[model samples]
Target: MSRVAPQGVLKSRRFRDYLFMTVGILITAWGLDAFLIPNKLVAGGVSGLSTVLYYTLQDKGLTVPVGVMMLAMNLVLLVVAVSFKGWRYGAKTIYGMVALSVAVDGLAPFTPHLASHDPLLAVLYGGVVTGIGMGLVFKARGNTGGTDIVAQLLADRSNFGVGQMMLAADASVTLVAALKFGPDLALYGAVAVVIMGRVIDLVQEGLSVEKVAYIISEHSDRIADAILHELGRGATGLSSRGMYSGEAREMIFTVVSRRELDALKALVHAVDPGAFMIISDIHEALGEGFKENGV
Candidate 1:
């Protein structure tokens, strides 16, 4: 598992990662420029602060591109990240940051403004798109610079969850934005962040949310095989015993998507009417038919 690739191959893979990160940056920039910027709605994080500053400066007749501000802020955090976290930690971050900064600036020129009358609709659209872009960057093993670096470092040194740390940082930025953008805008930003948060989960986990099925039946083998052949999903058989009856039996475990739920249930019931089954939601079902390797 701890193997290093050849230098040439490593460089090639690095380039590919950079390419994907660039696409993510471009998509993120388009979302911001088109939906969020036009409607004065913001999500949390470095991008959110940049949006606030962009409009703040706009009011002062000074034109500072949001991307440029983002780059500057990220550079400050990048330096701090490297100073404490080490060079290797910041290397990919630097590459991602620079590429994202440039892509955001470059793509802004071409991105169309949605100019939607409803601020809520714009927030939803922008949040989802930006979340997708961020998810792609994460999938490529790239960083988004700014507070992500700081949050990651902090999360690593403590028992806190990374998501929680990130949320704290993002909420702080939105709070600051509120002081300048007004209370209502702040609330709108929060709503946007909520939407974006969910979208990021969906993108990273794959949209095909699954349901895990646990079966306890007399003929567990038959049900498991049916699930495997009919549903194209793997099933595990476990040794289980009846608590009250003092009899041993086999239990089956399988995961399938929402569309396959009815079929899976039907299959188990058809095989054994007395089959006991449990189903639960799977937030992220990676591997196999889920997210592809290296993505």
Candidate 2:
């Protein structure tokens, strides 16, 4: 009975994971079809190379759509991923790559020039849509499975980090674009890639950035009360021995949003004018009243 239950649980979890993966792939397809492809702005990884190749061939009257090229390129990269990174990593990437490829191809017929001639607007919208798609994939613990697999393999074998390896791969595509197209379009592509990457990081994490606040005050109880009553936040009290004075002290440890920092500081000041305080950014926070679990 116990073994059967475990198997059943595993199957359920796999089903849920597949659902999330499908959603991520669909969002990626929408971004490419609705924004990125329309703009001709290449982002980083295998998709970027596909964009470059699509335009290069289009000029010669032998056009291959970005989605088709992306599928082919990812298929090639999947071989390398399996050969170098072992079957586990390859297996993880294969489904996502195939799904994204199929989705992209399915979405290909609907691509229209939404941004027209406005390069800046194209870049902005393309970056945002691409970022959201990438964010969803990352949040699902799946890869777009482009050059990301190559990046990982290289990072494991070389001294470079994943980011550096990915940047190098994308830069190679941008260089190819510069040689085939003009430097201006290549530069715009680079900017679009950078913006998309940053936006992905921001979205995958949450909009409201967290900050850790430390407070040392004489009126610790009063400050804690204010934080609870006014701010509806929680705090932890720590007993500390002051290094400078060799005196006992009570410190408050709390986490708040960036917007709440000023209010927290004011509260500390109001309670104890001579309070010592420090604040630092917290990249991720998860709990009740904050970003929920698994998000």
Candidate 3:
């Protein structure tokens, strides 16, 4: 029974991942066909390349669907991805890219142009929608398998980071867009890229503005008590020895929301004016008072 339960759980998790990938791909397709493609906003990746080719070929009297071009390009990239990263890496990516390609083309005819006359609106909405979709796909441990695969391969062979590599690859596409589509549209594409990146991060990590604070003070107990009572937050005391002072001290570590930061600071100062505090941003906080067991 125990073994069966574990297998069931594993199957459930996998199903969830595939479901996320499917929905993510569909949302991404809608965003591209409705907003980005109609407005000619080439925000990078295989989609951007497809947009450029679609228009260029259109000018040459060839009308190829953007989704078809994307799928073709992704197929070539997927071969490279599998050659280097192995078949295990290709599974989810294959599904993600193929589904996305089909979805984009399938919905293109029915999807309305959301921002046909407003370039700024197109960038904003398209970026948010696509970013959200991509983020969900990533969270499900799936890859879209275009420039992402290229960027990963480049990063493995070079000292540059994956982000830097992705930037370079995507930037090249934008540069091509600049030459083919003109500077104004290319600039909007850049803005869409920035917005998409930001939204993706928010989707993956959440928009929780949690701050981690390390407080060092003589009155650690007092400050901790205040945090527990006044702020309704928990704090831990860590034994530390100051390198410069050669004195053993207790440091207070606490996590609080951004809204409580000022109050925390004030409470700490009121307890010990000479206390040292180091505050940093935390993407997410789970367990206990924060998110309650990563829910």
Candidate 4:
């Protein structure tokens, strides 16, 4: 297990985390108010169920706010988290969940019903806004305190990864939505979940999607130099023996942006026309010329 940092250091780390959490909360609230609530659209998690129930009751002439239902469902999930994961895990989640609930309720009055009849537009916009919010929360290492905690715990105890577990859990909810709201709404909800998950991954990875280039060439030095000078990126040479040739060779390794990828290939081709190079996508790049530490 990873050790917890000291209280002071942890507090410093939490400053940015809290800021992101607030941003996430606001975004989620907007999504609920502007899209999901107005259109009676159900998403994937507890929020989805809350939306479903809100509309169901409203159809029967009862008026219960979705925000209230969201809070109640999250509180119930918090209890489950405490029982299964203990107080330490539950503490952070409780804070985040409560804060989000309060923000949702507070923003409720300000959010006007704009597109109550357009389900497609509601799903599109709601999914995007909610996805952004979910991404922010994930970047802060905080769960939305929905079925996410349960999914994570199940994943840890089972053979599945967290992502897989989340998919399974959300799938069950989606199935219920399909039974209740028909296939179209369920399909849209599934799309929303997938989009939301992908956006979360992208945001957590940050803006580091550089391309890693591996060059096996005779003119390794020239290629390396070109990468350094032209691409403004660093290259490292690794000594390796070719299995087929049984001779030692210097392999050049470097990372460059997707935009600079063509330039890098051109540089490599210019330096050594016959150089063997492998290029792969890098989801993130950090340090030195890239995203600096503490920035």
C-alpha positional error of residue 183 in candidate 3 after TM-score superposition, expressed in Å: 1.6
Candidate 3 ranges with C-alpha deviation above 4 Å = 1-4, 241-244
Please identify which of the two predictions, 1 or 3, would achieve the higher TM-score against the true structure: 3
Per-candidate TM-score against the hidden true structure: 0.84, 0.85, 0.92, 0.88
Give candidate 4 misplaced runs (Cα > 4 Å).
Answer: 1-9, 207-209
Tens digits of per-residue lDDT for model 1, 1-295: 7666689778888788778787887788788888987677768888888888998999999999888998999989878777886786646788777877777788787877784787777888988898888777887788778777768878988899888888888889889878988888888889989987788777767655689988999889889889888888899988888989989998898888899999999999899999998899877776888655552
**Candidate closer to the true structure by TM-score (higher is better), 1 or 4:** 4
User: TM-score ranking from best to worst?
Assistant: 3, 4, 2, 1
Error of 4 at 219 (Å): 1.7
TM-score of 2: 0.85
Worst 10 residues of 1 by lDDT: 286-295
Q: Candidate 1 at residue 74, lDDT?
A: 90
**Could you tell me the TM-score of candidate 3?**
0.92
lDDT of 1 at 289: 81
Ranking by lDDT: 3, 1, 4, 2
Instruction: Give me the overall lDDT of model 1.
Output: 0.83
- RMSD to the native, candidate 3? 2.2
Model with the higher lDDT, candidate 1 or 3: 3
Clashing pairs in 1: none
lDDT assessment of candidate 4: 0.80
The lDDT per prediction is 0.83, 0.79, 0.92, 0.80
